[model samples]
Target: MDEQTATEAMDNFTAIWNTYTLEGEVVHWLACSLYAACRKGSTPTVGKGLMEGNCVSLTRILRSSKLSLIQFFSKMRKWADMSNLSQDFRLRMDRLERNFEVSTVIFRKFEPIFMDMFQNPQGAEPPRQPRSRKHRRLPCHISDVFKFCWTLFVYTKGLPPLYRADGHVSSDEPPPCVLERLCELHDGLVVEAKGIKQHYFKPYIQKLFQKQILKGHEELLTEMLDPQNFIDNNKAINREYEEYVLTVGDFDERVFLGADADEEIGTPRKIIQEMTTSQTAAQSQLQQHVEKSGSLAPSTPLTGRVYLKEKDLLVTPVSSATQSVGRLQSMVAGLRTAPSDHLMQIFKSCSRDPTESILARVKTLGQTFKEHYTNDSDDTPGAHIEILYYKILENVIVQETKRLHGRDMSVLLEQDIFHCSLMACCLEVVLFSY
Candidate 1:
């Protein structure tokens, strides 16, 4: 292979191989190919015969080709043993590589921010003024080694656990491991809010309410119950987070879009607004009321507001949205770790195929694997084949979630379309159970 080809192959190989446990057969093939290439003092001509070499021979060949065979082998060994390398070492290796490894990709992501900082040194966010480090890059410091190490740590540690003994994920799991961290964050927020309430309101309220003129805590009540205060405090954070999610979704679309696709597509915000309006309109029609004469009144419609206020409720809108997200995240977490007994029940309740069932799918998947992939089969239950189908199911869940912008547009609908789309593929008619 030429320099370009070699670099490309290594990039593709390291991108996955660095993170995953490669099968023995795959490792042998890679080893043999590297060995043969080393023997020839150039890129090895990979073929069936060259891919079945001994591990020792393969290691020698890799050393001959890359000159960093020791480190590479160490990484491979850790992967085989299902262990992790030092975060610092991993970051160093990733950056030293002349290809797009995870560290390099992260650095590239921060490029725009770096350029902005360089242009206007006095900006509001001047690249966070990297913490003073001992070993900075030459000539005013190109990069921070510690920062890179931390970034690598975050990417690997924060990344969702992709491998299980079964080598599979479930239908209802979140895409990134970030979701779990987000859950932790949600809990932290709740704790903080509770602290704020206890510290600021509890003591002050007792004294304020004790005043006879106030009459039964009404003086302190207005300070707490006013909807305007909730909006005023949380509006900025809510707007910023909403904008960030929209931007991320847009980025995902841009990455996935075909080259021929138009660049001027409608923004997610516009699409979501339109959908929300339509859903609100539909809900209004359902809640429409008639006067005592039994004739429908033109002005009487169901609660058409995005948020309905209860007479005695006490929660900020942002707090409610946060709780909703936490619930959704928990639902995902439950689906991941639950056993077959509970798993089957969850799927049965959600799927359109109440009879065929996830249990049925599990069994059918086994048969299909035995029939077509018998030689490749392992002793594990619903191994690789079943996992592949489960991944597809998970992807469908993501699509449906995105379609509704993480809100149940059909929450107003009597039937559970969101549930059906995420879990039920076979049901022809989903009855609204509002």
Candidate 2:
């Protein structure tokens, strides 16, 4: 691709690719954008084939861009940790501190302090209030991530097994695997939040970056807003991280606006304020409330998405020439592997009709590979999934399989993966479940 074309492709795909980079390596993904851009509108040719004018081999570039196994996994193992995960944890934790800052301002402080400076209401009764300083919110530092996760770990029902897996909790330090799982939970939280964010929050980009609602001082806001404010000559990305400015104690002053602008304690909505009297008459009948118990629905199984790893994954031995490439890939990358007894039995149970067998397996798999939690206050099961978790043994797998074809806004990942991975699932579910 030409340099200009490549730059445009990078810009267009950056945000979408950013989500992937959160979970994978950053280096090779540019190759993805480049590969897509070259084929965008022009081109009838596809695959590892050469681009017409540039004569560049797209496959070669993509293959070469992958990360080296030496960087993480051993020649024998399936997976390893990367520095990017920890780096992202710190970065996202810092960003969250700033994002929530705008919500921390007190209602009383809004009128006199923030509203006076920005809105400048006429005939206000504050007598030109004296300046005061107080903490608005707590600093959410990288240390806080570990601290909160440690709290969760302390009471987690599953933690004992995890702790014992690494020895005991009464050592010089807590279990390292627990720490790893803690970070995994954080990552999963960010993933789910960002999905909802892209749907619900990003449209109001102003609340994220606007200055008038939050800016107390023009110069400071301008300085913080500038991407180049704190850049180092050697850094690949901007050092400013301007999102951090939101946590510097700026709040949305608009809370004091609307019908309640003049109210002393602030306006109340029609809830109880509109009631004719504080004490209600029998004429105003009090109605009993009723609630419904919806049947529990576990998440659908994720299938299909067996893309080539952008980095090294499982390394199969040389002697296993009879082993399927699917089996080798199952270790870390592909959803293909040798069938487990559970899976073989699924198909064997109904050899006359594979469809019935597949659907049954889907239900069981869906019910099994799920997360669970517990609380101390109730006699209810410690495993949140509970009897429902094993409901698969009876109706789970079949129920999930019936849902295999449907439209859902939320299980987009599961839907996409299910279709893509359906053919090879018998080989993959063993590891997928484990």
Candidate 3:
């Protein structure tokens, strides 16, 4: 390096010596770091004020994208969920931005659908939707749309990258979320759930309140989680979080998907022990892998950073089938045993193999469709949703025929069916709840 350049660099380093510590190009941003503390109630580590600093407005940063709320936040939500932020925040995300324009537009389109999903409108047609977006109330509560998105975001940790203001998805897919099944369980439980105490949720919550789970709060929980008193969780916010050297705790999954605790509620002890052993084995393997490479490569300087953007989304349609089956099984959990297995068989039968002749495929599935249309009652799981699916599929088929250029999903189906197996795939996926 030039002597002049070296002298200038040394002078600059000397000026900011209090702000950062450097030892042979290593930087410790002691007080001048830009990384702001987010998640609202996070406590400081390394004495107080370590992470306390001036903040940049993430909302302002996002506004530069000029995208709708769903589009802008959808990808970020997915990344955050993948990072297990839900486990940290416990579904308390920042409030929705004041984009009533986009939220109201989607709500308006789905108002009639939500209203009549439960009850069949007694007329030749459903109620006419209001033309004005400014109306405070409509046929269905506008908050229902927000509620749907909120529930979906909390459970699944994401929403679809919706492009349209009228609540249409970019793909010819069914509704992005299968919320009916979840709602069914909640509604059923709510009838019996007079209050938090009535559900006996505290016992299950108590098991998770271990120091290994919440960390450092072992003593605090003794007093905090006493029975006959409301657990003041707000006071729990001041506790700092700690991480191990190499791996995320295997209990991370427990925190993310509390299904294990839910399942063990009334389960046999032998089964729970066996499941616990299996989980321990799996986690040991994961811990070994994590130790080898760690969370980042060359973990010396800790310079690795990540930014969430629209590019990270995977656009496959398999998620539809997965959620549908989950929703169907959940909705029917009280009514039937082995609903998931039965639903899977039905879905497999409805969607034929890709290599099969279109005529043979359609003819066999067409027969199945006729049976469904004739036999299924409107009160059944996904009965109304099935109609909505087929109706959308019909519209998709029409649009494909008239479009100048179309994309190919399957070669054989595209040759014979013109629009390809999107229609067939849609049926298979939508049939999850059906």
Q: Tell me, by lDDT, which candidate is best.
A: 1
Global lDDT scores for all candidate models: 0.36, 0.33, 0.35
Ranking, lDDT, top scorer first: 1, 3, 2
What are the per-residue Cα lDDT tens digits for candidate 3 across 74-135? 44344344333454433322333233233333334433444434432222242455788675
Q: Judged by TM-score, which candidate is best?
A: 2
Candidate 2 overall lDDT versus native? 0.33
Per-prediction CA RMSD (Å): 27.9, 27.1, 30.8
Segments of candidate 2 deviating more than 4 angstroms: 1-83, 86-89, 101-274, 278-392, 399-434
TM-scores, in order shown? 0.17, 0.18, 0.17
Error of 1 at 408 (Å): 9.5
- In the predicted model 2, the residue pairs found to clash are 303-417, 304-420, 304-421, 363-396, 363-397, 364-397
Worst 10 residues of 3 by lDDT: 245-254
Tens-place lDDT digits, model 1, residues 1-434: 34553454455456546666354334443543332222233322347233211222332333344323333434444443343435643453344332223433444333444333333222233133447866332221223322222232232222222311132222453223232343353333545544434444333334334432122335334432133333332333234333332322111111112232222111121111123567988766756644333544345455354465666777887777667545534434323321244334434444253424444545654565457534434432224334433444556545555543453322222233433343333111111110
